[model samples]
Structures are given as C-alpha cells and as structure tokens.
Target chain A: MQQCYGSIIRRQRHFIRCLGGDRCNNSSSDTLLLLNDNTRMQSVMSRSNPAIEADALSILRSISPTLDSTKHKGQAGKIAVVGGCREYTGAPYFSAISALKIGADLSHVICTKDAAPVIKSYSPELIVHPLLEESYSVRDEDRQSVATVVLAEVDKWMERFDCLVIGPGLGRDPFLLDCVSDIMKHARRSNVPMVIDGDGLFLVTNRLDLVSGYPLAVLTPNVNEYKRLVQKVLNCEVNDQDGPEQLLSLASSIGGVTILRKGQSDNISDGKEVRSVSIFGSPRRCGGQGDILSGSVAVFLAWARKLVDKEGHTLNPTMLGCIAGSALMRKAASLAFEDKKRSTLTTDIIECLGRSLEDICPVG
Target chain B: MQQCYGSIIRRQRHFIRCLGGDRCNNSSSDTLLLLNDNTRMQSVMSRSNPAIEADALSILRSISPTLDSTKHKGQAGKIAVVGGCREYTGAPYFSAISALKIGADLSHVICTKDAAPVIKSYSPELIVHPLLEESYSVRDEDRQSVATVVLAEVDKWMERFDCLVIGPGLGRDPFLLDCVSDIMKHARRSNVPMVIDGDGLFLVTNRLDLVSGYPLAVLTPNVNEYKRLVQKVLNCEVNDQDGPEQLLSLASSIGGVTILRKGQSDNISDGKEVRSVSIFGSPRRCGGQGDILSGSVAVFLAWARKLVDKEGHTLNPTMLGCIAGSALMRKAASLAFEDKKRSTLTTDIIECLGRSLEDICPVG
Candidate 1:
C-alpha cells in the first residue's frame, strides 16, 4: 500500500508539473530538465488507461519550448546522427533530413568517409562529417590512432548536440562500433540524451555497459532489435502475451534508460511503466521508414529534454520524446499513405511532417 | 431507343476499358491510348449528364506506375506540347512545363523559333524545340515548304511523345494553325494521342476532320470553346440543363473523341456516357489554371493507358483521365488558393501540382 501510494503521489506531482503555470513558458534548460525528470516519474506510475496517453501528449506540448525570434540558431534543437556507412547512406540521410524538416534548428550527420559525400549529395541542408573509419579502411597498426581521432572529433560536437540519434545506417564494423561505443560513453558523461537504433542496437546489445544505467539514453529498437535486446537483457525470448511486462523488465534492467519498441504500436517505457502509441500508420512496409522515426525521436527528445530542464519539471524527457515522435511519425505516414497508397515512400511521409504537426497542434 | 442503347453499350464498353478490364489490356497504347480514344468518342457523341465524373483520383493512383530505382529514365512518361508563339509564350510554357513538375521523366515543348529562346529562358529543365513557323516569318510563296519543314520536324519527335498537348500560347495565325493541323494529322496517323486546348481548340472547331474519327484525340475547351463546340457539333446552343447529355452526344458525334468542358465542375464525356469531376477547386480564377489542367490530362492519359494495359481491365481510360486530371488540377488550385489567397497566380498553382499529386497518390 505504501509503494502504491508513493507511485500515486509521484504521478500526481507530474500532472501538476504538466499544468505548472507560467514557468512552462521559459527556455532555460533547468526547467526542461525538471519537466523531463517529473514526466519520467509520472510515466513510471501512470500506465493503466488511455488518459495516460492523453497525459503524454499534453506533457509533450507543454515541454516543447515555443519557437521564438530572440532564440539563437541552435536553441530550437541541434541533432546529430552517429550512423551512415557504405550501402546505407540513405538511412542516415533520411534520419538527419527528417530532423530538419520537423523544425530542428540544425542537424548534423557523423558518418564514415565513404558515406559522407554520398549522403551530402542527397541534400545540402545537412552537415555531413566524414570522420569515422570503417573496418575495411582501418589497418591493424593504425586502429588505436584512428579510434582516438574519431572519439576526439565526436567529443568536440557532443556538448552542442541536444540529442544524438545513434543508429539509422551504422553498419556492423568492429573498429567503427568500438569508436561509437566510446562516443556513447562520453555523451552519457556529459548528460546528453541519446536515441539508439539500427546498427547501434547491434553494438549496444553486445556491450550493455554503454547505455545500461544511463537514464537519459533511449533505445529505439524495431521488432528484431527489440527481440535481441529482450533476449539478452531479460535472458528470455519475446513473450507477446505479456509485452508490456517484458518491456518493463527490459527498461528496468537497463537502469531506467528509455526504451521505445517500434511495431504496429510503439511501446515506450523507462523501467517503471509502459505507454503505447498505436495511432494510425500506413500498412505499406517500404524500407527506410524507420530512419525517419529515429530522426524524429532525436529532435523531439532534444526539445523535450530542454523543456524539462527549463521548467524543473519532474518528468522523463526521453519518454515524452518517444510519445511525441511516435505520434508525429505515425500521423505523417498516415497522411502520406492516404495520397500515395502503396507507392508511399519514406520521403513522401517526411514531406507531410509539417502539415501533420500543424493539424495536431496549430501554430497561432 | 435503339440508337440510345447502342451509344450506351459503347459508353459502357469504354467505361469498362477505362477501368482497366480485359478487353483493352493488350492494346499498344495501353490505358492512356484507350482514354484518349474514349475521349475522342465522347467528343464525337456529345452526350451530357451533370453527375457522372470519373473517379479521377483513383485512376491517377492506378495509372501512376510505381517508381523503382532499377527503371531508367524515360520509362515513366514522355510528353510534348505544341504551342508557344511570340505573343503567348507563357501559355504553351505552362502546358508543356507542368508535365515534368508532376513526375513525367521528359517533357518537350515544340514552339515557334521566335518563342524558343524566351520559353527556354523560363526553365532549363525543358527540351524546347524551335521548329514551328509563324505567318509573319514566312512569305506566301514559301508557305508550303515552311509547313513541310515544321511537320517534318514534329514528325521526327512524334513517335517518342506518348501524348501531345496543342495550343496554349498558339496565336491566331492562319499559317501556323494550318501547320498544326498537318502535325495533328501525322500524330493521328502514327496513333499518337493529342490533348487539344487554347488555340488548338479554335483550330479543331473549324476543321473537325483532324480529329473526326481519330479515337486518340481529346479537346479541353473552356466556357467559350465549349459553346462553340456545342454550336458546331450539335448545331444547337449551349444547354447547361442537359450539359452531361450534350457532352456525351458531342463526344459520340465526333467518333468517340473525348471532350473535357472546364467549369465549376469539369464535365467529361465520350459518346457512351458522361462523368464529372466535381472535386473542390479554388475560386481564384487564375489565367494559368487551364494550362495546368491540359498538362495534367496528358500525364493522366499516359498513366491510365499504361494501367489498363497491365491490368487488362475494361474501363474508359478517357473518363478516368479526365477525372484524375480534373481532381489533381482542382486540388493544386485549391492548395495554392489557401496559401496565396486572392494573390494566387498560375505559377503558384503549378507548384502545388506536385503536392496535390502526392496527396492523392503517395510515392509509397
């Protein structure tokens, strides 16, 4: 009974913070951090009904800072994608481009040298950095020096990025993964939020220490990725019958780090409770759609994180980010599919992002 | 009753063919060819009904072939517009130009030599052919050779053009009109479909034989041109009360040629039946909207033709083409109106064409 009462009080506190009058209007990172911490607490306690879902959306809206003219260039959001290699430039490009399209002030892509120019050719809007060396390009003697250079380069930009999307097109390369692991550790040290996906999941699944116990870290894994994570973390295969319970266990095992499991319904959790976003989405399963989702998550996460810090609102920015990103991506995909039908591509969905956001939360 | 039944049977057959039924599948021109042919039939019959516009959005979706990276350039659709004179460069430019904006791989404009430089200056994307001759440039003695040269030049490119849109900026020059007449004849002989509008409508009303029995000709006439068509084809005045029937009869009377009578509701018919595209359109009354409509029809006709060929469905491709074209044009116009409001121009409407098409048929 004491534990239940404690959970209820925490949820009520989050609800109050969501309604926390004028301070929600500020731009300071402390308020945003508070909001993120409280929202995370509320999500941990309030998971029984659809009202929890409504609460999630409201928290997102509340914490998403207003776009103001006085704000500097990167105030809105500076997102970086730590992915992209040979044969997969389109994924990282899609992820980074999606962030900008969704109103992020700036977006950067940290990819391998081979993938940089190709992703750059896809769009001039992105700042593509060709620093990471893949296994095929690295020599045995030069591995240590190459790895050091990659880490130092990523460290320079770590503080500037509000959020990092760590998967998309990251291929499975031993040298590359090792370097990214270091980058993840440094980001955690700086208290920067991270959303892991794509090949990043492959690395994280093997080296749980990289994200385990890092509260700001977010693992956005699709079905296969989530399955492996569950098996590795929970020591069991997927149990569809108790999805929420398994997800809760997975998040708890990761030491309160957020987990956004992508499926027909996106289930979000951070050890304490689980929330599902099962909004309408297109049935057409074209490739690279997941890249858009990862990119969107990064931007929203940054915004949510900032809002939480500024408001001192006690909610998990990562959880709020997952909900908002899932909703927006689903809405955009539905809007695109309505027009394109079976021919709807990821780019088409990306184009509808602005319109879909306007539809939900009108900008006056 | 017998005659009416016969016409109805023909209309139904055309409708089935347009829907991409078995009968029209194997035909060379495919669904686009069938639609152009059906539109010619509708023009010949000149029947009327206020309510029966084809399901153009669906047709557009059906006919728009899937985009795959494996496919090379020019496999989608290639179109050309024959218009653009010294005084009216923008009209032909609008017509020939909109084709590429809506995803046609290649769009060419065959205009007078004097109009070529200006039209080319408008967009480097277009392949502008400077092969047409105007009366001011040719002496009476050289008229025949000039006409032959123009016809020969157009003929060289005719086989490559999936559809032709005649008369956007075509001036009221007798010599140029005569050459266009010969060009139309060759297009008919080579079984190339034509979408006639602007000055081309003026030429067709005077010398109906250019499209008399050709099943691949479509005439897009505005309020005034429609009036002239009613007077010339049915030897009667415009009857808005029986507009659908009149359109059906007019299409049938011209040997199954299709007629798209543009208005608040775009009325389309072949001799067999009538379909109307009552989709919402902007009230902006912009000048270049008609050009957008003509170019859109060309693309839809091409796409509908291919859809019916591959699916082997029996529905009137002409009706489908008109419906799709009218729906898309209206959607673009409506979207432009929302943004530019009363200040909307043709160029604004043209830009909206892509979004409009994307709205109806996403590139999934």
Candidate 2:
C-alpha cells in the first residue's frame, strides 16, 4: 500500500519539476495558467472518487528542506507551542516534542507557571516558559498588567520562531484565552504562520476575527471542533454529503484562511481547492494525536513557506503543510499500531514519526 | 552463567505465552492455580542450597514490557529520585540517569536548591527541581512554612510519577529529612510507590511509621543500612545462619513491605516468600550500585504494577520488581566489569543497562 503511494508521489514530483522548469521560461500569466491547469488535471483524475485526496507524499518531499551540514541550528526551523496550563500539560509537551522529532531545531512551550515544572519534566529537549496566566491566578485589577507582561515575554521570542502552534492542551479559561488572543494578534502582525488546534480552535471559532483574513493561519479542527466552526462561520450544520464544498465555503467564509478538517480522511482547504489525506492510520483515537498533528503542521508549514519565499514557487504553503502533516501523522500512527495494536498511544505514534518521515523522504 | 540465565528467561517467556493463550478459555481459578504451581515448581527447583534463589532472569523478562512503537513517553516509566542535597549530587544523578538508560521515558530529580545546578550541569537529559531546603538555609521561625512549601511543591507532582526513589544522595540534614518525611507520608497517602535507599533508609529506619504499613514501599539497603534496619525492626544482630528467615522477619515486621538486601546474592523478601538473585555479579563493591538498583527497581516496579493492573496477573508485582531489578543490575555490573575491570565506575554500569536489558529481552 505504501509503495503504491510512493510511486504516485514520485509521478507528482515529476509533474511539479516540469512545471517549475516551464515557469522559468514562460511569462507569469502563462505560468499561473499552467498551475491552474495542473490543479484541474489532478482534480479530474481524482474525480473517480468523491473525496479529492492530495498528493501528500509529493508535497511533503517537495517542501522538506534538504538537511545541510552548513545550515545552523535554527536554520532548520524553530517552533513554539503556546499552550499548557495546570489542567493541561501533556498536550503542549506532545506538540513541542513532535515538532522537534519532525526535524525542527528548537521547540519551545509557553505555559502557565503551574504547568512548567511538569511539562519540563516530560522532555529536556523543549524550552518551557512559565509565562501565561489563567483566570484563577490573575486578579481582575491586575489582569491588564499581567496581559502586557505575558505578551512582552512572548514578543521577545516572536521574531525568532519560524512558526507557532497556538493550542494543543490550551484550556478555555477566559483570562488565559484573552492573553492568547493578544499573542495571536502580535504573531499575525509579525506575519509569522500559526497552526491553531485544540482550544485554539475553540478560541478562534468563537472569535473569528482572531484568525480571519490571515492567509498564514492554519486552523486544524476535529469533528466536533469543525462542527462548531461550521456553525459559527457558515451559520449552518455540517453537510456530510458535501463535506469538501462546505469545507471550502467554510474556509472562504473565514476570509480564505486554511482549515484542515480532521476525520477518517483529513480534508484540507484554503478556499482555493480541497484536498484529502486518506492514507493508512491507526484506529486508536488517542487524545493527544491532534497535538502531534498541529506540531507537525507548524514545522512543515514553516518549511513550505520558506521554500515558496526563497524559490518563488506559487504553491499554497498552508495547504501543502496540511497535506504533508496529515499524511505523515497517519503513516506514523499506522506504524505504531502495527507494533502496539490495541495498546497504541500518542507517544508511540511520536516515536514512529522520525522513522515515518525517513521512509517517505530519506535524510540522505 | 549468562547463557544459562538467558535460556531460563527464554523458557519462562514461552511458558507465559502459553499461559496467556490458555487464559482466554480457562477460568480465573485455573489461571491462579497454574500461576501458584509455576511459582512453587521454580521455588522447589532452586531449593538445592541453603538460600532459595529466584529465577531472576525469568522474572525480569516476564515483567519487562516489550518495546512497542504504540507506547507513549511515560508509559514505559516516569521515575523521580527525591535526593541530591548540597553535599551529594552524583548519587541522585546516577540513580535518575540509570532509570533513563534502562528505558524509562523520563527521569526527574528533586534536590536541594544548591544541588540543582550541579545536577543539571551533569546531564541535560534529566529534569532537575531545586526545591528542597536544609537547616542552615531556613531560619528557625520560617522552618514550618518552608517545610509546608516544600511539601506542596512535591505534592503537586506526586501523582504523575510512576515510582519515586527516595534518597540517593539525600544528605542527613534534620530539616531536609523532616521535609522528606512529610513527602513520604504524602506519597503513602497518595498510594504512589516509593523505593527507599541511601539517606532515605536512614530516615525510614529512625521513623518506621512513615512506611510502616505501605506494601508499595521497597527498602533497598546496603550492608550498614541493612544492619540498622535489622536492628531497628527485629531488635537483634545480623544472623547469617538464618539469613533468608531473618530477611523475611524483617520485611514482615515492616508490615509486608518489600526489602532488597544488597549483598553478594542480593536477598529479596516481602515476608511471604524469600527470593535471592544469585546471578553472576562483579566483585566491585561500588558506592552508586545501590542508587542504580533503586532506580531500576522503581522502573520495573512501575511496569510490573501496570501489567498486573491491566492483565489481572496473580504475581506480586513488588517481588517481581525486586527480582528483575536485581538480575538486570547484576548483569550490567558484570558487563561493565568485563570492559573496564578495576576502573568500572557507576556510570559504566549505567551505560550497560540498555545492552543488559536487550540481552535478556531483545526488542526485536
């Protein structure tokens, strides 16, 4: 099954190479038309099935930066997870660690004071900051000052991070969410890409303005989260009969921000086109799996953006990131399940991440 | 001797597989009978000498969970060493790092403030908490509040740890011991298993009530510490003539808590059955071997407890933990001795833990 996927990915890579070569010689208008034509061809080929599955493996290969010895530590990528409170530590740890395991150079976690020691204990690889404040910990009189302090603390490291994973285990404490919303504004202002998941989805779903019109923002929502988002944005129930079209509309309604609707087949759309990643995955619906997906997307998104900015490719970086992250997560989960079966957990999938990436795109 | 031990472990694994398959159709009573019968047969076979040695290698294999990709970080084990004061740091580092080398996903050290930086400098892999306080640091008036604060700090993370190894380089400070006593009492209240060694043995020997009726407590005592425990508990001198019986009485007097007596044969008992791990060990009477033993016992104990809890096994997890810990420590020590000979330090023995475990239970 994997070999067949690999062959299809190889063909897609060949097509992309041809497109890149043609763009070098052709006019910008002609190149743009060629890109559209390529997308149309892929859509037609995939029309045999209702869901338009993405060439996720090819997108992953094309965007993954070739590891160079000359490159410095942070050159690979620096990802920060802005989640972790007294109630939730494992989610942030899973996300941050997943980023590092997926080849990010540095992974940081910005969490509340109560969660720092425990999350720090999870892995020494992560740089954990006990900066954020929850409602219970912050008094109403001191909320304004504390919010400023929290934003200032994150602002110092904002420019350095290639991307930020906004929520993994982020709890929905009103005061904490307010501070995170501020952080999101600063990140968006800095033009840094953000992957929102877990409670971040909750935050953005209720207050769409936090991510609306931010092309760099990626919202990854599971079934219930997507339902809530659809209700909030589209003002209607989720239409399973036309999930892709509705997802595309949902993205478009949110001002063209990318939305990756997580399910048996993860559907990603950027209001331009819909893509699905239906590769093999484990049946275990573990809690922290989404955190891993968010972290992976953050790293891949950063790499994809870097590729487009440097190589001048017209690919949708957010869409590419979602496709690659979903594919890799599913592949890793499948490998973990093969070994652990009924006992499969989030950490098992995490351990297989490096091997899975290597299987798809060897470091050599 | 190592080959002989490996064969015994292999045979035991085969037996366990057959028994596990039988468990699907067989009644619980039949399974219990088979378990007891197996234990009895092994005991009878090892009764050729004065000391009844356990099939340590087999016990280690049975308790050691297979390394599956589906397991998360802490699922293998999350151990904490509550030791390392200003005066002594290497012992706690040895204990905590030994746990990681033996396959625990995370290892933490709760030490005195002054010891934290030194321990942290030793290895970035360990999560070191500088929370404990000694007499000189705390004023007479602030002692109570300081103690309370220290206890609270540890209490917050008490539930997350799989097992706690109390006192590897824990100094003999009155104030620190008092704080640790409170921590131990809290751990007992929370039902978190503790392995007491080094200065922890001193604290427990003087104040037996802290772990009096706690079956989850495992006391790992060296020669002098064992002498003190025997004197404190049985109120008598050491008796080599009836070593196993004396060990049994000592453990029984402690209300069925497991005791791993460090010596040539490493006798273990829980007042129920006396099992000695007389596997081939190095002649090196090293200082930090007990710390390694404490750490290894904590991991194995956690694994054994998890297995029993999930699989409904009939064996005593604590006893199995002691046996497995003893066998692996011995095997690692022997391997380290073969390589370094006279220069085999505690670190050398620690470096051998992974290979030693792999030899007994291959990951493949």
Q: Model 1 over residues B242-329: C-alpha lDDT tens digits?
A: 6666777789899999889898778887676566776778999878789988988998888777673645434566666777888889
Backbone clash pairs in model 1 (N, Cα, C under 3 Å; residues 3+ apart or in different chains), count:
122
- Over A1-364, each residue of candidate 1 has an lDDT whose tens digit, in order, gives 5577455545444443443423333435323433456544354344442113324456556656677578899888999999977535667888999999888989999999867876787788999999998887889999999999999999998999999999777888888899999999899999888888889999999999999999888898877788899889989999875676678779989899999987756788887656677666766555566788888888888887666355544447788788888988888989987776543556778899998887877665
* Candidate 2 chain B minimal-lDDT segment of 10 residues: B16-25
Best by TM-score: 2
- TM-score (all chains, Cα) for each model: 0.48, 0.66
